[model samples]
Target: MTDDQAYAGTAEGQGPVQIDEELARHLDNKRTELFEEFEIRDTFPDDVLIEAKNATQDPEADIEEELESGDRVDCRDLTTCTIDPVDAQDFDDAISIERLDDGRYHLWVHIADVTHYVHPGSEMWEEAVKRGNTVYLPAYTIHMLPPVLAETVCSLVPNEDRLAHTVEMKIDPETLSYEEIDIYKSVIHSDERLTYKQAEKRLDDETAELHDELTLVHELADKLHEQRKEDGSLVLNPARDRAHTIIEECMLKANKAVTHELQWVRGLEAMFRVHPQPTPQEWDKALREIQELDGVSIPGDAWDDPRKAVNATLEQAPGRQLNKIQWAVMKVMPRAKYMSDPFGGHHALNFEIYGHFTSPIRRLSDLVNHWIIYQNEGPEDHDLAELCDHASARQKAGETCERLYKQFLQEVGLDPHAVNARGLEVVEDEEDAELTEEEADTESAELDL
Candidate 1:
């Protein structure tokens, strides 16, 4: 599910709500029930955790070895920065951009090289395949990889040299198309980390550290976003801010570049995202429903393309009706799935070829693609189609679990958005504090797999 769909009516940046012990227990029980119903694994196996701990033991020595062996490119000199949510734990991606003398743009997207640590024949790899992707609940997260590994070595923390899979693109100034693309392994040092709010501030303040770079990138990202809308791409979130636009456009460009290399240049099979278009009748039904909404109108010029029509309506629709408009479109839209062939293009993104590459830490498809690109070989013993099906199923299950969990929170008179933003604080009586601590310890021990 998209962010707008998952968090439709929730306000952002709310403070944490204090809950009594009784309510906290109720929330915990509901989460346990949902996990069982969806078959979501909440704990890592002992072997996987042990392997992750061992892998992160000597990071400095490993970097020196990799650099000395000439297997990785040296990019620590570049000015790189990561932009994520304020509460983000593990930073998986970062970006750096520059304006060239020829009026073109040079963009570098660096993603954590997760395949270097978790590959085939490893316990962590097996567990990651079983999980498929990270399951995110309100104020909670079930990581695909062990946190000891993902949060330490694989995280792109600031002021640290870390291994990365970098996509370097030289984009045309006029067309916003890639003039040159290069994908390679590198070691990078992030100069700083900025939250989404901080990034917006940088864009407004000319005296900020990364003000120039952010300004240049936002210009390119805005143009790219406009180009996507013009080419019939469906954008559900019309109010997305400049920080989000910069990140979204850059990641889409990098993912497209990697998949284009895999299919057209290398002639190999990888997990491609294929979103089937809704039937013509279904599109008509959605349009009719949207038109009936008060104060909403679809321009006549965009009627030929349903995606464009929705985009146009959303831009002009009232803020209160945004959720309804999105639901109208989503009800008729087909769920996108992964496939070994890139023949069926993604209907929503309106890309001829698209796949995952920028988020290897949480997604199985991106992790598999990283391995394939690095080794230049497809999985010989594995069924690619089966993997694709498993990923799609698990993703659906995760989404369902999250939806149910959020509904339960609302039923209990707690704001899901508030809990998600500021987290929950369990308030206990003075006499029950010790007992509560004991019970929590017991529960922690039970969860340590």
Candidate 2:
């Protein structure tokens, strides 16, 4: 049965009942019950634990050696910084901006070099591959890599000389045109770590430390945003805050730059983060639903030119209804995923080619991209299609786990002690099932809703 139908029980020969308080309570109860009953993989297996321990052993020595021998660019003098959540432990990406003598903007994006430590075919790599990505819970996180590696050695903390896969792009300050792209290994020292809350203050405050750099980054991002709009990119603001835009734009540029370099310059076999174009039928259905449900008038050519249509619809929508409409549209859309064939491109970003080269500490695809970018080892030996499929499945699982955990929190208010003690037991039946191919497929299909 569909989730809606299963949750809000249907009368004989009737459709799913409309949401009411009773339905809400009933759903909440069911979620709590499921939280207790569901076969949740809360922790790593003993084998994984042993493997992670081995991988993290002698981390200090490993890091020091890599720093000495690895390709390095001294970007310590650059006004680089990290913007993330206040409670974030691992700062995986950092950004810096400078005006070149030619009046073009030099934007530098440095991503944590997790692959430098987690070598191919190593125990940590195996663990990362199995977990796929970090499962971020509201209260805790199940990291893909052990904390020794993900939280410390590879984290781009301030003032630390960390190995990084760097993307340096020179863009015209006037035209916002990307003039040159350079991808290489580098060592960077972050000057500051600003949370989104702190970053919002720097928007117009000229006296802010690194104010000039922040302003340049913001302006470059704004220009790049306008350029993306011109390219017919579908702009979806999941986080509406302006401060978030600075980080988002920088990361997008880095990912896009890496993908473009791999596809055109290196000619290496690589995996990409691709978003297929929404089918005309899917677009039409979403618009029809919005019109019928909210009585909002969407542009007639929304399906033909989605970027314009969506913006116009949002403009017409009331501020409160904006999120509702966006959510509805997103529900009907296909999920973005990883792929071996870089030619698929990313329709949502309006990029001719795109890949996830940042956040290797969290994502396996990014780690693979780093390997291809730095080590010149393509994912050719691995079954690209299978790897992509596994990564996508793991990502979906993480999302599902997180969603369910949120529901649990809503049902039972924030009492950390109670929540922690409640479901500490592992399901004996499922504990041995370490996300095999068949199991992943079944779980992913179940959570596809």
- lDDT, model 1, position 329: 86
Residue 379 shift from truth in candidate 2, angstroms: 5.0
lDDT of 2 by residue, 323-390 (tens): 66676668666788888887767777767788888789988898888988886766445676788888
| Pairs that collide, model 1 | none
lDDT of 1 by residue, 9-56 (tens): 322544355777888788889889998999999998899999998888
TM-scores, one per candidate: 0.92, 0.79
lDDT of each: 0.84, 0.69
lDDT of 1 at 72: 94
How does residue 401 of candidate 2 score in lDDT? 68
Query: For model 2, what is the alpha-carbon lDDT of residue 256?
Result: 79
Query: What's model 2's overall lDDT?
Result: 0.69
In terms of lDDT, the best-performing candidate is 1
After superposition, the stretches of candidate 2 with alpha carbons farther than 4 Å from their true spots are 1-41, 44-70, 292-295, 299-303, 379-381, 414-449
